[model samples]
Target: MNKIDLTITDAFKNKVINPVYLPYLNNETRTQIYFGGSSSGKSYFLAQRAVLDVISGGHNYLIVRKVARTLSKSVFNEITKAIGFLKLTPYFTINKSDLVITCVNGYQILFAGLDDVEKIKSITPAKNVVTDIWIEEATETDYDDIKQLNKRLRGKSLVKKRLILSFNPVYQTHWIYVEYFAGKWEESKNCYSNDDLSILKTTYRDNKFLMPDDIRELENETDPYYKAVYSDGKWGVLGHVIFKNWRTEDLSEKAKPFSMFQNGLDFGYAADPAAPTHNHFDRKNMTLYILDARYCYEMTNDLLAAEIKNMIDRQVITCDCAEPKSIKELRQHGVTAIAAKKGKDSVNFGIQWLQKLQIVIHYTLKEAINEFTVYKWREDKDGNVLPEPIDKNNHIIDSIRYALENEMAIIDRPKRDRPMPKRGAL
Candidate 1:
């Protein structure tokens, strides 16, 4: 064995290995995910584990992050620090140009990042045996992209392989978390053990090395609405929604068939484009599906009329509404368009109604989804969820509420009626 590999092994034996990492070391699964809040020693543990694998006669291990910049800034520094602190210089040499470490025993550690889609596609394993693959900040990459990368690690007959992921919880409601970890737990009615393919949770509390002040700071600074998500890893709703129970998948499958289609036009002549959102309402299911979106800048009434005619020809739009001039123009073109009557109160009412329902959305309308995810309630001085003025960046959601309010008017009727109060003697 090379002197550096020996030294690295000794360091892992003495200073690096901790009880917290034992579960991972003992886990038999080929895939593992370690996710939690910030500053929980996840990265450090991952690096140390990879080094141990290399020193133990492993020939093909890779340490990767989201991008080259992050590898250079964070992961690179952590590995170097471990190498230096462990006094492993004599046993191995770091090839700076190729970003690899080679030990005397022929084991190799390659460092790379998977930020660009093309770069990820171009990656080919040096040997048929890729023993280890580590991804830091795994959430930044698309879930489907990660799945594709996992398929590339097929090994030869003699090779054994493993994949590790580390991420801080950010989007709890995101598809990846919801489908894999949360869904699994909900089905099994138990926390994921080391035997499971997924490890859905970890927290700063699990790490003994964090300073008290740091923990206190995170606890104090995080807003109440977001504290459970960021600190405790709980799932909850975010921002304004027409249907709180509604998700993108619901709209595609259950609500599409019953839709009564219409269009909502927000008009602008020169400064901003005339933007129209095509909507389909399924009255039977009490769901609204936003089918398509179109915007054209600085168009004359003649051109706008042609566009409206094309849309009508495609499907029967029961009604359409726009601003006063746009409405008059549509009438002149022999299409019946009226100005929609809705005040702030009515708009808010629609949004509230939508929030109460379970709805699904199509993924292609990412802009609308983004708007919904970031829409938040106003918070008080003490960082509490409060009913008050709306938060910022809610224009898209507002537009959606406007369209739905005009078309759908289904309200939740009470199941039981309260007896009228008995009249007292005047």
Candidate 2:
């Protein structure tokens, strides 16, 4: 086999990298974190990206976990799987006992654990200095472990010396979150980046190839806290959650037989995103079905009009009243748009209205799922839960509130007295 084929193998990579991770293909951040729920493909994607990085340029890449025994079944297996997926097995030497892969060109991929400090210290690549490091299950290691490992990538070269961390966020108090994500509430989005740091948040929804049974199993999770942390891939909040009457479902098929369809819009730009949603209400069953929701940035009225038409042409879309000019422009562009009649205390009233019925969100709406998971009542400086919710991380939800405003007058179906679900107290 010609080694040159490996150099021009975008085709192989196409089969390896998932669509959700395509945005970071050329990432040069000093610190890149691939974190979310379990089975989110974060670890696998990291291994796959590292495999491609090794071929594009020559370097010593170290992949580590907390213990030596765990590396074989986890990151090590993922690396070998990535090699097989990209059909690059012929160009590299895999030393199973040493847990190393060496390219024909003398670049190396090394595996170690913090437990084997001397082994990690003795490691040196044949051709290049340590150019990259991936700390798998990073939550297992402390701040000092990363501080020492960060020093390993000493000499610079043609490529960016990246320090990659992959883990399922297990605790809000974890060092990683406090260090990099304490004040940034918007970090729950699909992607967040600054100059030298990048963060990607994903859930099972982002993995399109997941089997139906696998999805069913995950969505069937009953423990609210477990579902939030593992299934939805958001940092679970234990108390004072606003909406527990809602759950995610495979709604594309479930909502097909419904007769009524309406839409909603919440306008945003720059720091905030334009949120739009398609919904259906069942008066008798007291169910509000969120069929679709989107979080988009830098969208203009023309683009928003186009997006509305694409979702459901000619449907009555209730939009924020403050954007009357936007509504007028949308009307000019042929969108059946109107303003929502939000009166005094409309935000609180909307929350009260929604809390009365069961909400079933479409399983694929990842951003919306995250909003539902994290949206909580605001608190005063002394930590009293305010009547209104925190304003951010709630664009999709605001659209839902606007979309279903007209139905609030409908006589609510007799709700069974059931205990509201709460995240387990940590």
Candidate with best lDDT? 2
User: Candidate 2, clashing residue pairs?
Assistant: none
List candidate 1 segments past 4 Å from native. Answer: 1-14, 95-98, 124-128, 157-159, 186-191, 194-200, 235-371, 381-426
Give the lowest summed-lDDT range of ten residues in model 1.
Answer: 417-426
Alpha carbon deviation, residue 370, candidate 1 (Å): 5.7
For model 2, the stretches where C-alpha displacement exceeds 4 angstroms are: 1-12, 239-426
lDDT of 1 by residue, 199-263 (tens): 74655666676799978966774455456555654444463322335456534564446536666
Q: Give the distance in Å from residue 2's predicted Cα in candidate 2 to where it truly belongs.
A: 14
Candidate 2 C-alpha lDDT tens digits along 253-345 = 788798797689999975588888999988888888999887655668998889888987899999999989999999999999999987766
Q: What is the lDDT of candidate 2?
A: 0.78
CA lDDT scores, all candidates in order: 0.58, 0.78
User: Using Cα atoms with residue i matched to residue i, what is each candidate's TM-score against the true structure?
Assistant: 0.56, 0.55
